[model samples]
Target: MRIRATAAAVSITGVLALSAFAVPAAQAADAASGKAAFSSASADATSGTTTTSTLDVTFSDMKVNNGKNIAVGTTNVVSVPVTYTLTHPADMDTSSDHFASGPLIYRGSSPDTASNMLISDDPATCTATSSTTMSCKGVIYVRPADGDLMNADAGTWNAGALAVDDSGDHTMQGGLGTTKVQRYSKLTANAGPEPVVKGRTITTTGKLTRANWEDNQYHGYTNQPVKLQFRKAGTSTYTTIKTVYSDSYGNVKATATAQYDGYWRLSFAGTTTTPAVNATGDFVDVQ
Candidate 1:
């Protein structure tokens, strides 16, 4: 991948400042010689070499995904937003064709040795606020279908910054910030009998599931707290009736007295590795 400043009018190729150290082999080859193509095998591997240097530039005020957990689903790409400030020498011309800069997030001890890392697919757009300071914005595209992520990759990840100058010298700074990657959650609800006698018992059941990157499927999310909520017909609000926990198979069930025509659904509060979700409401009639 190429690294470039937003204000630069020229898009330079053959320079892998942001990807030279930790990029996949295929991508590295494509960057270095522009002959190879990216494949699943290359995308699945995260091991690579490291290049470190001390430059006069510094990165600060970095934020990834707006400092929120990134929820990724199977078969879809998750594009994360990143913003930061770049401070460098007053005489340095970042807008020059030979200069490039960008941001990245990685999981592991360091960016160079990270088990997994994500770099911006596009160059960052930066606007100079002063002679030596710039405000930058960019994106990191996470493709789950490409084997870029796995179940084990969930949780916290560290952020870093990179840059390359006219002399072909590059520098990277790690431990700049952190963010979380989580699986997208799903919930389902079904209530029966459809028409019940007044004062009779109405049963509501549901299931909680989340994406499993390993199998590219959604699996049970068991033993988690879920809310059973009900909304009377003609009303726009739902009220919690009870709390239930998912079983070994991620099943949840609750019962309530049939007093009025209403809808029932399940709501999950979510965990660090999964996002909150609400099932579609199931309608029931009380006669």
Candidate 2:
């Protein structure tokens, strides 16, 4: 929402040209963890009954350059200010987009600019085709293909669209409810054996539930191979369990048995035909 520089407790200056700063050394942080937390939805309304028939949003990775020779540390929380301009829905003029600078899931150049910056409606492609009409989805790419550490060589950072569908309130009936929607722009990448278990250090146990994938209109999780890997607490490595398929309700059942006690993460990827990957909805702490 607001873009401002946050000072990390220490600032190293003058050693390098003010604009000649180095990119922070990549750490062992997990991008999947950051994405799962950022790509969530929120709804609001008041008084007579305001409804959001649709909501679309795009995202990008968090980017940083110490333009002023500001020394950054390992603990500095980098903020990626995601900007969105909404073309108010025809029936609703009062709507807002929320959440910014909370996580590092997204880290790359954002396509948002003040002149071309917006939340919902897009000038190039929209059904209404007019500036006055509000659009439902946001066309944002949270990160480019290279940004995903898992497969940096791909060099195909892409854009996907999030869309909310036919949902709103009826003043006459006094009923109000909103349905969350998601759409994945197809991606082409090497579809390999499901994510492998990076070797186990500890024992872990948890259930797997799909969040964003289930909402897409094309595929509904039936007969689809979803692979997930986990590790025990205190360890960064992951271990592959069985390759599970999504059930009718778009849910997967998983149980982890790690060799040691520690933290865990489950990484998801589609089969050979579809090459999109998703991370766990929640982190598991194995004690």
Candidate 3:
């Protein structure tokens, strides 16, 4: 079969991020949801007509579909971008209904039941970089009702691909695999006693937490170091004054002698499992 290339880009409405593997025996998503909308296979049937033959797919720099970290109001959309390169001995005619597809599921230490279906909205947009390699960027959405697929703390995940034949009867899967993880966090800060004596101590308190995908809750992120910084009034530079660690409940507290009128804030340097975060500035007046 002769390979033909077209520039078709998938315009997804919205999304989040995550991994891949053998899709469950049942279709993880609804009929019109995710890659399933265009995908024809489920966990039960992901292999080939010729058992020895398989397609080649590689992914790099995968992230939340919208390309942003997890935040309070957001992180609900179900999509992640998989920048990839596809290579196969067989020609992948973009003109055919057959293309790339899979599920972006949670494969962390304990996997989340929810998954995002993978699909290339526009197969034509996928490029033929060479006779045997094609470069493409596609999306996998967490889908309606599914939440936080990539919200793990340095969690482990993967992205799987398959080359569906033109007939759609044969599926050569496990094209390429890559590890996926989520590094996102949240924090809060507050300062009390708006007006204080210059020599008196001011107490600053805050909380640190990351998304808990399994229960969809935000619990305290324990035993993490956080820096307390201060900025004099009308200044843009913030100088670190002290370091503190979150308590068992991810709550943080520290006291500093007030010397000048300014803003005080707490910042978490974060860890491999969580992204760094800075609490909003809390302004205080020194009398």
Candidate 4:
């Protein structure tokens, strides 16, 4: 049988064949088990006649929970919610709960396990929104250090959806979309001339980096805006002094006149492609 992954379809009928867009092992197992009972009972059959075309299925309004930019390496367990609306043709058999649908994640160039693979928790649990349309929702986790997409496999990853009737007659898979996120960003700052005279300029320098799935290492981010902020030694609020931009190497530098004994730090507001991050405060003592 043909299973669609991304734009093209590949051949694999195993109970659980991993792919960029997969049926998932749990769902596939359920489909395999359930289909055996009704294999001879083909879909859109009329009086046991063999005149029919394949079942029709289409998807719409796909959404990912916790936002689409999947940032990893900060927390271990990342909560992900999968939601989509689909249209099922009237010809197919929808008489029972023999349906399954979920998301699939693959890393390292392909869906092969040697690179990475992730699947939904369940299949075919979507609630019916209309006679021809159904809305399905499920949750999945991205653990950089522990889950299927391991920390070692850091880099760009892909996500998709697969829906099936499990009656061996109709199936539909979502577009081969990207998570568009690498790894969580890390920021660090250091101040020179710590015990500076009352009027000396305090210089703060730092670096910004994030996960690069291509080579599997943290790389510098270039041309991004970051804020230099400070808080009094005894106070908690941090006041923004100036906005500093990261260089081609993701390096940051800022200078401020020593005023009061307080803490100095750099913050990144982040962008559509990355998540916001803040570095720990660096304390400077003024004489």
Candidate 5:
């Protein structure tokens, strides 16, 4: 069996004795225990038939670091044992079969330790106890560090957050057929709080306006962009409004041109730049 680790994925191929996919192993089938089982030869059948049989197996290149072809600069290794089983059925026919299982392809460390294994291609358990020579395929397990294919099981979102550096541009692809990205808000304890001006009073009619200085506290808040709603004293429904960009630090404000002034709340008028993944900001209210 041959396992090749690439920067993208692990590729596997080879001839085998059994024709089935590898299955995960139970505690009873630990690699150490399996290693012991493959260290002996079989005995003949007890049937009255004059035929007798025996089997012997050996393993090679049981570690990923020892793989023949590996991606350059990728420190991860692929470790999986490759075994060849020789079978003599009834002593009259002798055939050989190959079997491979375990973590299969791993990038770093041993799977028996803290490493993650391949979900599908590789199985923890592998065997060649069949009467005939069984030929099976190799399992190639791989895990990526930065970007990975999307996971459909977790709703339509990707399995992990969209990670972007100060100005890094990254493309996403792969996994479960379709591709998608999951973007999350990037608020941290050290980033400070959203600018909040308690008891903001509004007197004008159009979209509510605010002192630009109050909105400037949130570093990422863009010009007068507002996205929120409100209603007058006797109104049953609320109306939506747009935000105008702020020029002077004190001119920042979200506004609506309605002419009823019983009481109005400041609707946050937020705008985002292109490539929405990096957009995030706080809103302010206006009378």
Candidate 6:
């Protein structure tokens, strides 16, 4: 099952300490004893020193979602893949059960004080490449319905990594890289009349819409410029005929002289919060 860290839990400095050691429900019973001990040790360690400690560990070559924008719809859960290289002291055994690590993406300046964050549901799986080097892979799950994302959260997010040892010592690092989270966008076009006299005015209409995380629905992306293009029926080329801006209701309309049989469509250039989209061409016949 996919799990999310609550805002209250993730906003604290010990966020990584708790998340790094999280266990799946199925294994909770068996891990209960170990978890309790780790919690106690963590409390004792925090009482003696600051949470952020310099450790002989570093994360590099970190990549999130294969370096592409993460577009998420309203209902479907989005699973993002993350991979990174971890370098640590030769004596630190990262693959042991006593060690845990994971990657996270957040919108705020720092991971510890992030207003919104996404983290892997489980600890990363690491394979040893040498005594002190390893390759790690993990998945971060985003569920929009669970309030995991808001429309405002769509944009550039900073990547971060964290690791915790058996003794509750932990380190968190941010600014490793960055990734974009976009709202899925949709566009539609329709041209009429189906068969019109040569040189007659052909009206093309369309709408630009994008996912709204707040309501789990697609709403008008108003006041955005969209391109209207035409493709000759027999040819494979589409030339821009004109540029139209979406109205207050996200509706776009344009008129063109129909001189030949062709298809008409609308193309949106997109923005930081939304991905570019093209409407399937609507065919029109000229008599």
Best by lDDT: 6
For candidate 2, write residues 13-113 as lDDT tens digits.
Answer: 11011101111114214333332222232222111222222233222221212111111112222222222222333554222221111111111222111
Better of 2 and 5 by lDDT: 2
TM-scores, all models, native as reference: 0.80, 0.25, 0.64, 0.61, 0.25, 0.85
lDDT per residue as tens, model 1, 1-83: 32222211111221243434324444443454421221101111112322335346778899999988899999898889999
The per-candidate count of clashes, in order, stands at 0, 32, 16, 5, 32, 0
Candidate lDDT values, in order:
0.73, 0.26, 0.51, 0.61, 0.25, 0.77
Segments in model 1 whose C-alpha atoms lie over 4 Å from true places: 1-52
TM-score of 3: 0.64
Better of 5 and 6 by lDDT: 6
Name the candidate that leads on TM-score.
6
> Tens-digit lDDT track for model 4 on 1-287?
11223322221221222221223355655655554533343222111111132436665666665445778654456667767776786554443344555655555344322144556644535677667877877666665544344345444555545554554544324244556444678899997687989989999999998765444467788989999999989999999999989999999999999989999999999765567899999999999
- Between candidates 4 and 6, the TM-score winner: 6
The sequence of per-residue lDDT tens digits that candidate 3 reaches over residues 1-287 is 00111111111110101111112325344213434422423323222112222224333333333444322223465445655555644555543233443323233111112133234333323567677666666655442224434344244343443344332222322323434344447888898678998899999999998776555667898999999999999899999999999999999998899999999999998665576789998999999
Expressed as tens digits, the lDDT of each residue in 38-90 for candidate 6 is 44432211111122444457788899999999989888999999999888999
* Error in Å for residue 162 of model 4: 3.1
Model 4, global lDDT? 0.61
Q: What TM-score does prediction 2 earn?
A: 0.25
Q: Residue by residue across 76-142, what tens digits does model 5's lDDT show?
A: 2333222222222333222112222222322222212212223224422433456633323233432
List where candidate 2 sits over 4 angstroms from the true fold: 1-182, 185-220, 271-275, 281-287
- Candidate 4 — number of clashing residue pairs? 5
